[model samples]
Target chain A: MQLKNIFQEGAIAAHFIAESIAKHATKTEIGGHNIFLGQVRADDIDGKKVTAIEYTSHVDMALEKMHEIREAIFAKYPLTCMHVHHSLGVIKAGEICLFVFTSSKHRKAAIDACAECVERIKAELPIWGKEIFEGDGYQWKVNN
Target chain B: MSIEIIFFGQLADKTGCSNVVVDNPGSIDALSMVMKMQYPNLATAKFVIAVNNKIVFDNEPIEENAKLAFMPPFSGG
Candidate 1:
């Protein structure tokens, strides 16, 4: 299962994508798992509160990047399975912003690979998001 | 030649248009043409350009009618 986005619930996404990765490892003797769940934190700008985040991307380009990432991770890590998902549209504060899951025969490798994958995506992907403030205002959050 | 240059997300908002066709380069990279076209002021916007989902950096000889899309830094999960 492959899906990405910052959804309504950060807790739900942590469980969901983790479950997806676990299911793929049932047939293997894999042991540990690694996951990174990105959350939207409350940002105060000039007394304006960020109530939610609206994300967007070049769909075709993003999917292609994911595909390449999947291949890259496989070549770089010893893993039974991996998954990445990011939310699009409005997501409230303390909500799930991004999810990355990886499973391997051991915990160390899995954790390392997951971190690498997440870092690579953040540094290279073509996605964008804007923080929606409390009073009909917003700001784009790029590589920042 | 004449590949379409489409900006998405924040870039589009700044450029005021979703897409445009850049003048064909005799033999150069898409990035050069992109710099020459709209938003030349954004000459240093560190971003990637994709030709139909494939990254294009060098002059690599792309299709004349390719749908090129430029994207700024990704902030997705």
Candidate 2:
């Protein structure tokens, strides 16, 4: 099966999350679902508060890497389904930038798979974010 | 051989453009040498090379018209 494109243009909305959960109601085999949402934090950098993050990516490479991560996760865990979404454009502070959802027959698999997916995506994908400060200056965000 | 080099993130900003076609320096390390000379900022920038969408290590030979990307450390969620 082909992998889905995880990039979205704007912040992921709460309604979208609810819709995603509703779509899986028919899958009776799934007993538990775990989610990980990455929200943009308003960080004070050098006394300048960050207002938003403008995200960019090497789309072709990111998709290829994400596909590999998905395959590896599926091979390691007994998951019913998995979905990953990330914002590509500007996302304001306190906005949701990433959404990872995993479902499984048991809670452990779902929770573990969701956490693993978030970690792998953060490490492996070719996505970058420029932290936009309140005064219009920007800096490249580095993951800690 | 001529190859297309795509830069992302801060590398693109430093280079002032996102993509360019450059004379293939034959090997990945050779390409790095040429790029460092062309874009001085790259000399100290930490990045990885991907040839045809797969990350490659040192000494990987570049094929004719291959797509190569210089990518900085990822900061995705």
Candidate 3:
């Protein structure tokens, strides 16, 4: 199976997300849709504050893993569509880093599938985030 | 024979470079020994090894021109 590329060069734009939803309007069968957006938080470390997050990933491996997760989620849920996008490079605080959208005929399937996809992406993808502080310092982010 | 090894996240910082080409060390265990010797900081670092993009828990034989990667725990959203 050809792997779907999910990584975007920078933060996900709000207009791009709006366009995605607008395109899905043609699929009238979808009764419900769930969307999840991940934003960079301005976390304080000691006296320094987080200014941005730099994301990196093993591209080939991450795409392969994402494909597996997509297949599994499709098999587990009755969904009409699913889409995911993750930011690469540096994303500033308050910017969108990740976006997950799922649509299904029923609200329950869309809601559950969207949640599962986000959780699996966080745990499985070979991606890392470096939190850049106000001062030239940085720290690796740990998923909680 | 040589293998291509890539490091990710903090492992890359510790290694001073993102990738290296090393002589095939025969087995994953032996490869680890060689890597730790070359990059002593890795001796205390925690990471998982992936041979050709597949994570292997047990020591596995290294093939010629294999692509290996050292990855820390994932923190993607």
Per-candidate DockQ values are 0.65, 0.93, 0.93
> Where does model 3 exceed 4 Å of error?
none
Best by lDDT: 3
After TM-score superposition, what is the CA distance of residue A114 in candidate 1 from its true location, in Å? 0.7
* TM-scores, all models, native as reference: 0.80, 0.97, 0.98
Fraction of the real A/B interface contacts present in each candidate? 0.80, 0.96, 0.90
Ranking by lDDT: 3, 2, 1
TM-score of chain B of each: 0.71, 0.95, 0.96
Angstrom error of the Cα, residue B74, model 3: value is 0.9
**lDDT (tens digit, per residue) of candidate 2 on B1-77:** 68899999999988889998988889998999999999998988999999988899768889997889999999998
Write candidate 1's Cα lDDT for A9-116 as tens digits.
Answer: 223355676567657755577788888888888889989998988877777667777777878889988888877777777778997878887888999888999998
Model 1, residue A92: distance off in Å is 1.4
> Can you write out model 2's per-residue Cα lDDT over A64-129, one digit (the tens) per residue?
889999999999999999999999999999999999999999999999999999999999999999
DockQ: the better of candidates 1 and 3: 3
For A1-144, candidate 3 gives per-residue lDDT tens digits of 778999999999999999999999899999999999999999998988999999999989999989999999999999999999999999999999999999999999999999999999999999999999996889999998
Task: Assess the local accuracy of residue B35 in candidate 1 as a C-alpha lDDT between 0 and 100.
Answer: 58
What ranges in model 1 sit over 4 Å off?
A1-25, B22-46, B60-62
- As a whole number from 0 to 100, the lDDT of residue A23 in candidate 2 is 98
How does candidate 1 score on lDDT?
Answer: 0.73
